[model samples]
Target: MKQLFILFLFTSLFTSAQTLETIFIDNFEDGNAYNWESEIGWEVINDNGNYVFQGTGHRWAVSPTQRNSNIVITGKFKIITNVFHLNLLENSGRYFFGIHEGGVYFNNDETQIEDVQKEISLNEWHDFEVFTRNDSLAFSIDNENIISYKNNTGTNINAKLAFECLDDAQIQIDDLIIKREQIVYNQDAKWVKTGGPLGGIGYDVRVDPNDANIIYVTDNWAGIHKSYDGGRTWLQKINGIYSRTGSTNDAIPMFCLTIDPNNSNIIWAGTFGMRGVYRSTYKAELWEFRGNGIPNVENLTFRSFTIEPGNSDVVYLGCEWTLFEDEVPEGANGASRGKIYKTIYGGLNWIEVLDADALVRTIIVDPNNTNIVYAATGIFDRDHIAGSGVFKSTDGGENWIQINNGIKNLTVGDIEMHPSNSNILLAATGRLIGFSREPDSENGEILRTENGGETWNEVPVTFPSPDADDWTLFTYLEWDESDSNIVYCGASDRGFYKSTDGGRSFQPTTYNAPFINAGHIISIATHKEKPNWVIANSYGGGVFVSENGTFSWSDASRGYTG
Candidate 1:
């Protein structure tokens, strides 16, 4: 019996060095189809900007060789058929559920699978999960455990996972996840969750400036979480987070987090849209709403923010409109609504200091002179060239001027000021790949500005694996506080990178990043006390830690998922 379990996971290509997590994921955003063996009775079309398959009765879509004995497939599915007959991997036995039939059915043996009387509507969207394991096949709807069928009779090799509909039925599907083996990351790059109550993607992470053990991480759709015992455990520090009805975990999203340098207890979380900034004063134990001058209008998203080093009361926020959607609203204009705001009186009020049409993602204040500030505008794959240049403000941000003179890529991803020399500025710019099949384009660039973004020059950097030729874009640049010359840059899909020079050239770093499967290299952190200790955050793969240096990494994502 145990041999059957072991046989299900290990394919011929399986090796001791690497364990596969997710082999293939078809979110269908390409507007075209690939890898399917047959498209009979089915067509891939752009469903209001989301790619989905619209299939007719008796359609089949085959897959490539998945040699492992077990398989798991999931996606949002809806069928118009009165009786949905599905032949998974083989035609010898039929498995399906019908609105009229009342319960799930397996044709081979009625006792092989259990009956769960679940109602699936024709037009409404429903998620389905199916898996093969332990000489049994299981299927479920909306994550409910519904059916388990004996699986010894089907041919394993050259087998195909298929679907069949009856009576001129039509079905639609999206966000397909298919894998032959369950994901268990290996030793070199394992991810352990930092006990995040919210189990999705993390957009931002920060270690407290005062306490190395205190850390803060933000969920893409919920409140801020804090870990007192370094990241071993996490506490949802959302006493006053602004959110709608669901668990603060399901809110619009906490895009960024910042800890006050002077006061560790004071913190701010940037949220999506008009929810603006949520602040916590008493050790993040309780939260309260605080947005005075920042526009309270709809669609205003706070992307990036910063606070003055000595004066925690002074804050600068880079904000822009939420531009993309599955379907553009009728009569809605795709104009850029990027701007910067400032507040010197804590959160009592805010004042708009600059009005740039680019989507701003970073706001930096020179610690040497608070009067000089810079804002970076641009988003992944978004073309805001007319307004998407780095801008700077002198004399306390009263007014701004476009300072992107020599910089080539206008789609700014990040902007950083030098620690030793405040006049030296570093900028990263790029856009996400428009097509899923094509590699990320070579539009991203790292620029250096000695005159505070007045004139910029390209900084030479090398991308990891697949090497510099494969590097498409660069974002999320970090500096080693203990050694300013040792800098790190995230080469998006290309991989993580390092630079020994100040801002001139870079080579791929020692840390092996897995965001190619997880998310963008969003946030990378170096411990305040330990110059070599590092933590990198992924869009979905959770957190990774480097204990000895950049060369060694382990999965810190254990408790992140529920």
Candidate 2:
């Protein structure tokens, strides 16, 4: 009887594996559509009938719906484009083969895989396959081994598949084939130093005022890292910083980091995770929540921070307020609905002064007077929304007046005042938003105000039009502290431009910077100790250091991310 039972068990396992066959296939040809519905928690989009495998339903979703075992799925997909918009969650959720796993349907808390695959994009039909054998799982794209998982205890043996297209995307899929398999491939990259540049998304980076060699960088999805040897080697200082939102493989994104120039020991960091802002008096050895005055709600993005040059105690932060669809004023503000706060005594108390129903893009203090300040607000609406223009407050935050008279229909991004001259001000302006489609529309021009922003005029800079390489607007502008008359500007589509006579006339820098062309310059800071030692921050191309006044450049993003 025992021998007979063992034979029956083997037979049952074999039958289960064989029975895992293709039960349904929708080519969209037989006029028969599958019961397709989007998961309520996920965002879904349909391509223009080009991605359909058969008829007209090539569904794709970001942050896929999690599911469980006993499945064999395959599809013939052609990437056609180099865009793969997969937001695969880690540890917090499960991803088997390439399909994510978790949700209530799986009868468990969200379970996620610990590994991620590089974005697969080949403009040809590639066969994708996924299979599971009890506690083990495997996946492949076009027979090219991708990922495999083991020791996973999950239920609800079903999964959801969809397509994704965020920017100028197109794809096609057909001839889906599914079958059980006992073979699995090893497809994991061993953690080898490779002696190459450390790569990851760097959210915020700051140079230690006390020790220029000592640099601190916060990874947007990784934990906080510090380099004592000037970005040579990085050590993770995530003792108190939570990284639960990131993959066990990746780091949580630290949006902003600031160190008190007066006291390098006093450090502050703002995280984009479930945990909010954290402060460490002992240089990030240990940290505690410092988001008391700021909102404690979810998805609160702490963007820009400015410390009073003379008074380190006085700090200002630009934060993105949490806004729900129902909370908006019925098409009044569109996607722009955040606020700016200031704290005179560190984080003890915060005052909300500017509520323009728009994002406080950039904030800067008056170079001559600390009390006088300027804040640039603009609509963050992705589609179609207006900008709040530029606002100035002579009495700190007590009152403000829109100083955007000459600057009509311009969305202000960056504001910089001459270090020595209070009346000389330079602002970086664009159209209503960053992603304007109008080609002929004047995208960006440096506006100058010799009379403290009471009036303004466009500087003579040959801004590239949409026809010329699809270039658009200027991102960052900086005036030299040594010579306030010397200014530098960088654009997203175009490379770099410089102005010798303040904002009167401008010319492109000697360095074309083609490799760094796709990225926009974020901030340009001059070395206080060294003359002509300038550093520029690229949005995605990391950082560049220029020694010859923007005439020559070198890559300085040794430990930086996009």
Best candidate (score: TM-score): 1
Q: List lDDT for all candidates, in order.
A: 0.65, 0.56
Error of 2 at 350 (Å): 2.2
Model 2 / residue 303 / CA error / Å: 1.7
Model 2: weakest 10-residue lDDT segment is 99-108
Best by lDDT: 1
lDDT of 2 at 302: 66
What does candidate 2's lDDT look like per residue over 446-538, in tens digits? 778899889988777754443632234565677765676678876543567788887677777744444654245655665445456566654
* Model 1 per-residue lDDT tens digits across residues 489-538: 77664567777887788786654544425456677777658787777776
lDDT of 1 at 471: 43
- For candidate 1, the per-residue lDDT at 474 reads 76
Instruction: Give the least accurate 10-residue stretch of model 1, judged by summed lDDT.
Output: 11-20
